[model samples]
Target: MAGHATVPSSPEPSSLRALPPSAKLVVKTLEYEGRLTQAELVESTRLPDRTVRYALRELEDEDLVTSRISFADARQRVYSLTTAES
Candidate 1:
């Protein structure tokens, strides 16, 4: 009699699936530009205000981005990548 060998299932890769293309672009922009206002992100990304806002929110949730009120303009908020992220 022959016995079958048991096989273990492999776990999915976590780092492999990161931010989408647009989100990745947003992260890179923030990483290179330091801190940028919403308008600045729109200009740099050429994306609509709503789209930028959504992307920013997602990045924030991932701890890859952060925002704060601008000293120059309290009405405007500046966004930047987290120090922990590369």
Candidate 2:
């Protein structure tokens, strides 16, 4: 460990830190509002639907976000952060 640098207990934060700005905004929105549908995320974040979709995909790829069928509407999916951190 002579030349080793310190590391965070969880790698998700660092992984999140490397994500695109749009993805970060989506994460922030979820953190503040908890779970929300794609449309709700767009309305809350004020990001375009396509951008939100892309960001959600990015977050999902990194395992930072999870989505499930919305109970209110099966056509939509509710999204939330996988961890406490963004």
Judging by TM-score against the true structure, name the best candidate: 2
Candidate 2 CA-lDDT value: 0.84
Give the per-residue lDDT of model 1 (tens digit) for 1-86: 25633322211225215756677777767756667898999999999888888888887887667788999999999887676233
Cα error of candidate 2 at position 22, Å = 0.6
Cα deviation of 62 in candidate 2 (Å)?
0.2
Every candidate's lDDT: 0.72, 0.84
Worst 10 residues of 2 by lDDT: 3-12
In candidate 2, what are the lDDT values of residues 1-86, reduced to their tens digit?
A: 78653332333567888888999999888876778999999999999999999999998998888899999999999998887434
TM-score against native, each model: 0.74, 0.81
Tell me how many clashing residue pairs each candidate has.
0, 0
> 23, model 2: CA deviation in Å?
0.4
Best by lDDT: 2
